[model samples]
Target: MDLINGFITIFSSPITMLFIVMGSVLGVVVGAVPGLTASAAIAMLVPITYYIDPLSALAFLYVIGKAGRFGGSISAILFNTPGTTAAAATILDGHPMTQKGQAGKALKTASISSAIGDFTGEILLICGALTIATFTKQLGPPEYFAIYVCAFLIIGSVISSSVLKGIVSTLFGASLAMIGLDPITSEPRFTFGTIELYNGLSLVPLLIGLFVISEVFTQASHDHSKDGRHDTIKAKNPDDDHLSMAEVKRCLPFIGKGSAIGSVVGLLPGVGSAVACFVAYGEGRRKAKNGDKWGTGVIEGIAAPESANNAVSGPSMIPLLALGVPGSTIAAMLLGVFMIHGIQVGPQIFETSGDIVYGLFAAGLIGIVLYFLIGWFGSAFIGRQIDKVPPIMIYPSILAVACVSAYTARSSLFDVGLACLFGVIGYLMRVTNLSTAAAVIAFVLAPGAEQALRQSLLLSDNGFAIFMDRPVALAFFAIPVFAISLRIYSRMRSEKTPAEMLDTA
Candidate 1:
């Protein structure tokens, strides 16, 4: 009944409908452009949400996130360049299909599989988030703190190739998050005597800097002088441009499996679409009968990764809605939006803002249909248009927009400067293989973790031993320890040479 009202609310508002449509179109265009991600687009546009109503803002950004994941496949198939990191796995077979003159078929397969996978994840989100939130609401401060610790460790350990670097990145973000006044004490901590610093760094500027401006800086560093025109491969046969029923039937199993894998991955904080897509692709190949053909223009190959990539969109919101922990970079940005609108997230969200929550869910359903239609009929055209816009032109414009957006957040020049500073830091993190995503997530989660820990301590008569009394807290604490140990064991095993293995035998 709430959901039906949500649909009615959206359908009745022309402005809301217009924003959704615009978001769908813009998300595709941004995602189709190589080096431009949905995260960057969202970060740049987040400041704009300050002027809009909460539902419209949430609906617009939410749809963009959904559409953007699908749009990445456009560049991956047409140009062999992944528009976002999640689309990297798509390139394994997507570009190969284009080279084989089956770009249309691959795009169609990707669109269908992505829609199916995303739909599956959305159903899980609608059903699962509230249920999870119900359970989470029963947890005390000890449990919440432990959960935050688990998130910090798991995100730091898993997001980057090097565990040390990932941990360092997370610590860096936590340190930055500490720069404001102490919340409980109301005492200045790391302000360094600046009035603005007393309130803490603005998230809008920080996000714009890290995701949007950083990408601009990275792209500006690249040489586009030798870049030439990429010709679109025409289908050799008319059938090559069309997907048949048999092909869809054959791809269904892989699509289902990919969606499942993606949903599970999305439940884990900071294990993002990039990981989900690759994992799904690898699993699909392992289970497929003609696995050897995976890399050679197989429509099944396109279906697997594309499904998993987009499927992460919905379930990734579960943590935020349930536990107030963002599971992805996009979710982190949305956290800022929720705060901006004075809507408290977490278990009480459905109780407090049930209409808005249900409305957002309805908007997501509408977005899925809209993006699917656009992807099915116009992905090729979007790809061609994006291809014409050179990196030289795009990055500068993005840089300008990022700067303007940063400034717009607070109408402060200091925020713009802060953004530029973080852009350099973000670029450095990128070049050094550090997880910027981990840093952002940590920045968002750290304050809550600190509060929870402090509150738990205050409640405890036996100091640290209080955690021992709670089985749930203990379980949460044990997770990171177990994960880190397992990671170390795996690394050691992988590092062993053939000679070492033989000697051990």
Candidate 2:
């Protein structure tokens, strides 16, 4: 009953409607712009939320997060530029589709897939957060350590362009994570007396540099794939953007499953949108009869990552809402917004702040519709802008914004210098094909993993068996092992496949 009433309170307002539309449109616009990401958009907007109620505040961020994610695909499809790093997978096939003049079909597939993913995530949040939290509580150090091992060996192994490179990247990220103060001992391990190194590396500027800055330089430096066509950008593709009525129905199942993968993957700690989208794309590819055609402009290729990446948006909120621990980088920023506002984000949020919780959910559903309305109706006009918006035009603005955002982190010019320094590091990592995902995930999990390990060990008198003593921990143990084992099996199978022999020809 309260859920119903809460929805009414949020939905009945004209202002809320305005925010939903504004957030969706703006998120898409921002996300479509290279260097302007969903997290940056939401982080920039956190200040405005202070004037609004919690429900409205979250509604704005949620709508923007959903819309911005889809918007990232636009650049990925047209220019092979992923507005968000998660959209990297989309570029594999989406850009190929654009080259084939099927940009309309690609956009349609992306929109529908994204919607399904959004629904899947929200449904999970509504149905399973409490259960999942109760279950997740048993994840002690050993279990968590196992999970990291799985992400490194399993997720990272399959994700990189190559397994050796991926393993190397995972270790690289872990090593960077180890640079900060030793959690158990208070002594700085890798700082070598550098005060800036004492707190370790900050992720935001690092993210800004690694993704946005690297791409800018890559674009400026290389013109290999530049089509003369981007120079004549417009809103809609008149000849080939529209999909046939029957074509839409065919891809729904893949889209639905992709969304499910995104949402489910997003909820698991340490798994980001990239992993969710990759794993989802892998499944969609595996299930495809035209699996061989997957990386080469297939609709399934476009749909899988598109849906999975967007689907991660809704359930990505689950951890933040249920446990106050964020599930993604953007979620971490959103967590900061809540903390800045002096609000706790847990079960009581539903009980004491029922309207806010319910309203946010309701807003999420509405945001889905709004996102489609923008994509289906507004995308062509937006899509055509690719020719008009040059990387050079946007780079200066983004560089300014990045510097300012970094400077905002304590009004320190030193932080601004640090941001630039990390930007260079980010570029170097990309050149080396290092896994930035591993680096960020390790950054997030390292301290907690350290803390949990130390506390659990003390409680058990140094007995390592405490992990096995709990059923939930035991179950958690299976995921990483299974994930790693599957990767190894898949790698072995790929090595011996008929295609492997054909490659020698």
Candidate 3:
């Protein structure tokens, strides 16, 4: 009944529907462009949420996140360039099909598989988030703090090729989070006498600088003028342009397996769509009848990765909705939106904002359908259109929009300057191969972690011995230790193989 009302809420508003439509279209356009990502688009548009109703704002951005995942397949298939990191796995078979003049077939396969996978993940989210929240709500400050520690370690360890670099990025973000007044004492710590620093850094500027403006800086340094253009391959036959029932049947098993893999991965904090897609692709290949033919334009190859890539969109939100922990960069951005709207996330969110939560879920379903149709009927056209606009032109416009968006957040010149400063910092981090996503997630989680730790300590009668009494907290703390150990063991084992070492690098 709540879900139905949620649908009604979205349907009742013409403006909300319009935003969903616009977001879907824009998401595809943005994701079809190489070197642009859904995260950057969401960061640039976050300020616009301040002017709209919470449901409308959440729906708009949420839909874009959904649609954008599918849109990345457009460029991956058409140009061999992944519009987003998640689409990297798709290129294995996607571009090969395009080179074989079966681009339409690959695109359609991707569209169908992505929709099915995303739908599966959404259903799991709607069913599982509330259930998980029930248990999460029972947790005390000690358990919450333990969960935070687990997240920090897992994210820092897995997000980058270099575990040390990833941990450093996480620590850097945590340090930045400590720059303002102490939450408990209300005394300033690192303000350095700047009044603006008293409030710490605004998420708007940080997000814009790290994801949006930094990309602009990176793109600006690249010489797009000398980049070679690849022409879109035309289908050799009408059948090559349309997905057949036989093809769908053959791809169904891979799609299902990929969706399952993606949903499970999404539930784990810090493991993202890129990992899910590649894992799904590898698993599908290992199990497929045509295993040897996996990489040479097999439709199953496209089905596996595309499905898993988009499937991560929904279940990744589970941690955010249930435990107030963001599992991915997109979820971290959404966390900012939730705070901006004065909506509390986590277990209490269902009781406090059920309508908006369910409506967001409804919006996600509608978005999946919208993007599926667009991908099926118009992806080729959208891909060609994006190809016409060179990166040299696209990035400057994005830089301008990012600056304006930053200023719009608080209408402050200082925020804009802060954004530019972080832009340089972000550029350096990217060039240094550090995990910006890990840093952003840590920045968002640090305050809550600090509060939980302080609160737990305040309640403790026996100092550090309090954690010893809590089994759940102990279990939570153990997760990161186990994960880090497994990662180290795997790295040690892989070191013996030169090819595996190269792949790991």
Give each model's whole-structure lDDT: 0.90, 0.69, 0.91
Task: lDDT winner between 2 and 3, please give it.
Answer: 3
Candidate number of the best lDDT: 3
Off by over 4 Å in 1: 495-505
Per-residue lDDT of model 1, residues 366-421, tens digit only: 99899999999999988988888777877888888899999998899999999999
Native-to-model Cα distance after best TM-score fit, residue 413 in candidate 1, in Å: 0.9
- Per-residue lDDT tens digits for candidate 3, residues 1-505, read 8889889999999889899998899888888888899999999999999999999999999889888888999999999999888899899899999999999999999999999999999999999999999999999999999999999999999998888998999999888899889998999988899999898889999999999999999998888877656787788999989999999999999999999999999888889988899889888988888978877999999999899988888999999999999988889989999999999998999999999999999999998999999999999989888877777877888899999999999888899999999899999999998988999999999999999999999999997788999999999999989999998998887654422432332
* Candidate 1 TM-score, true structure as reference: 0.97
lDDT by residue (tens digit), candidate 2, 21-69: 8888988888787656786566546546656766677788888988898
What stretches of model 2 exceed 4 Å from their correct place?
1-22, 34-62, 76-106, 137-159, 162-203, 224-247, 261-305, 316-327, 332-359, 496-505
**Clash pairs (backbone) in predicted model 1:** none
RMSD of each: 3.0, 5.1, 1.8
